[model samples]
Target: MSRVILVFYGSYRQDRQGIKLARWIVEALAARGDRAELVDAKAVDLPMLDRRHSDYREGEAPAAMAALADRIAAADGFVFVAGEYNGGLQPGLKNLVDHYLPQFAWRPAAVASYSAGPFAGIRAATAWRTTLGAMGMVVTSTPLSLARIGGAFDTAGLPAGEDGGRLIKAFPRFADDLCWWIDAAKAQRAAERPPF
Candidate 1:
């Protein structure tokens, strides 16, 4: 069965490069028979963290926040396309995620971090592990770290050259790992209730 996966990209920059990677991820997931959607943080345009969805009355929350809460709860898995900034998580993504917690609980999440420099945003991806865990997602072990992301993915969201070739080869392992965990989580959730 095709899983409902959300590929989240959070970048507020004027000329965003990480979005290319996010688009590639969504296409790749779709090619693999997953119903993937790119949840662009810039497009969502949520305000800074304040009252979460659960904190608001049934219909009082912002339209975007309320709609995203429903989508998050329905998704079987999530993938974060993170961009490094000062060796830390992107503020846009951090803010978007902070808007809700329970909506993410019990799902599996994977991180694919990238940057224009050589570090590939590994630092930010590593930092996200604790945050993701705290938000109640089972983090995937396989990670996609892309360095000099502009060279790896073209503007059309396709892998470009040699670096792209290597990334394409590595993607299967990363995707399969997430799928495995998603299957396990789906089976478990169907079998019994989560003890919370």
Candidate 2:
């Protein structure tokens, strides 16, 4: 069976470049036959963190929050496409995720970080690792970082020019790592009950 993976992008910038990276991640994962969906923070338009989805009583959560919680709970894995802001997580993505806890538990999570500068959002990726781990996800060991986001790819997420070759080469290993964990987790979930 195909795994449903949610690729999240949390940039609300007037001129967001990280979106290219996000598109690339979703498209690339799709090409590998994973059912990948892009969950844009801006498009999702969730209000700032207040009442979490878990806080609401049954049938009481807002329509948007309830819908998103269902999607998150059904997904087998996740990819957080982050753009660095002052060497940390982007508010849009962080706020989107902060609304849930149990929904993210026991899943494999990956980080695909990018930036306009040379660092490729590595700092944000580092910080996000801690947060994802704390949220109970089995964060992937491999990370994809793209520097100079503006020139990395077109809207379709295809790699561009000199960077094309590097990205093409890097994606397979990253996907492989995530897939391995996904398979392992699925097998374990089927074989035994999770310890609460």
Candidate 3:
């Protein structure tokens, strides 16, 4: 089965809109019989980049960075559920994204953003999509959102109306597209001869 990593990129440890969205995405992905791993950025002790001035390579990086990269490389695809901070992607999410470069190559990615205000992290998602695109990731075209999250979501984590149905409907297509891209990338990589 294809594996997809769902990353919840919020600083909050307790239940929040981003985490809630991540859970739903993971559940939706799992329901399709795919392997979905939900990774919380809070749990990953990410520190600022500590690269040496002379050493351009990140050889033997800190355990947290190494683990973060492993999760990215292990999955055939990724889903990001992130919170908006100052009308942009949260610091935690940016830190996680900066940890790896080429390792993210050609993998598929989807993003869901949430915020209390009108934009609903749409600007943040746009920023994140650009960054991921530079890493050669096939970021999903359908960006999901829960605008005015404080009003839209109940304490139980359910969205308020049929509008959420549209969001939910978009998720499966995103997942299916990721699956397709992953399979295609794997096949293309395998075809390159390196057998010894």
Each candidate's lDDT (Cα)? 0.92, 0.89, 0.71
Q: Judge candidate 3 at residue 67 and give its lDDT.
A: 67
Write down the RMSD of candidate 1 (Cα, Å). 1.0
Global lDDT for candidate 3? Answer: 0.71
Worst 10 residues of 1 by lDDT: 154-163
Number of the candidate with higher lDDT, 1 or 3: 1
lDDT of 1: 0.92
Candidate 2: stretches off by over 4 Å: none
Q: Count the backbone clashes (under 3 Å) in each candidate.
A: 0, 0, 0
Taking the tens digit of each residue's C-alpha lDDT, what string does model 1 give over 52-138? 888999999999999999999999999999999998999999999999999999999999999898888999999998899999999
Question: Which numbered prediction scores highest in lDDT against the true structure?
Answer: 1
- Compare the candidates by TM-score and give the number of the best one: 1
RMSD, one per candidate, in order? 1.0, 1.3, 3.7
Per-residue lDDT tens digits for candidate 3, residues 146-183, read 67665564567665565466566666667777777767
lDDT of 2 by residue, 1-196 (tens): 6889999999998999888878778888898899999999899888999999999999999898899999999988999998999989899999999989999989999998888888889999999999999999999999888888788886566788656567778889988999888888888788886846
125 Cα displacement, candidate 1 (Å): 0.7
- Candidate 3 stretches greater than 4 Å from native: 13-15, 52-59, 193-196
Candidate 1 residue-wise lDDT at 64: 97
TM-score for each model: 0.97, 0.96, 0.82
